[model samples]
Target: MRWIWIDRILEFKPKQSARAVKCLSLAEDFFADHFPGWPVMPGALMLEGLAQTGGILVGEANDFKEKVILAKIPKAVFHREVLAGDEIVYDVELLHLRKEGATVAGKVLVGAALAVEAEIFFAHLDQSRSQQFFGDHNFVFTGELQRILGLVREAGKRPEQS
Candidate 1:
């Protein structure tokens, strides 16, 4: 099953930065096995959330022309345990964007407290090569993610109900 970790895209600035949020709940599958008595959100998943956020930012920079993939994670540090009901905000800033790859520094926050932080790197595959290797389906930024992005942006533009 394809997992879309982040719940919503709160803000996005093309080629620069983006912020996304995920609301954790007890019903999450990982909670069952992560810790039987005390459930905690896995650090790896949170990292993935950050990567996904940054990856989308990078993908949008070139209008989704190249297939973006997480190349490497130079660093990652977890400050505290993330529990169910916590809302994690992933803030990612593009450090470098090159023809072949990109890098982003990111932070995952629970409210004002920092939960995790790291540097994520992404590589852009040649369009023609990727299509041949992966059968032309964009694996990284699927329509599901893009749809959520558009919906969130549109919601932000709408007038709030009085």
Candidate 2:
């Protein structure tokens, strides 16, 4: 099953940055097991959510042509626990981009407070090698994720409220 952490894309700027949010719901399965009564969103999952947000940004940077995978996390620190009913935002910026890979620095924000900070690095799979195994189709940015980018673009068209 495809695990999509973020609920929707809030803002997307191709090759530059992206912002997305995930609202923790008490109904999420993990909560039931994480703690019998006091549920908390796992920090690793939070990082995964951040990676998904940054991954989309990196994929869009190359027009979704490269197979982008989280190669390494050089840094990540959790400042606060995320609980059900809280909304967290993933704000990521493209720090470096190249043919081989790219790096992104992001912050997980719960309102005005910083919940988590991380630096994610993505590596592009060798086209010739990957095609033999994964085929010509781009698997990194699937239909669901493309829809997210589309959603933000559409939202951008609406007249702003003064």
Best by TM-score: 1
TM-score of every candidate:
0.92, 0.91
What shift in Å separates residue 25 of candidate 1 from its native position after superposition?
Answer: 0.5
- Stretches off by above 4 angstroms in model 2 are 127-131, 159-162
Cα lDDT of model 2 by residue, 28-66, tens digit: 999999988988999999999999999999988888888
Q: Residue 111, candidate 2: how far off, in angstroms?
A: 0.6
Assess candidate 2 and give its TM-score to the true structure.
0.91
Q: What is the C-alpha RMSD of each candidate to the true structure, in Å?
A: 1.8, 1.8
Evaluated against the true structure, the overall lDDT of model 1 is 0.89
The Cα local distance difference test for each model comes to 0.89, 0.89
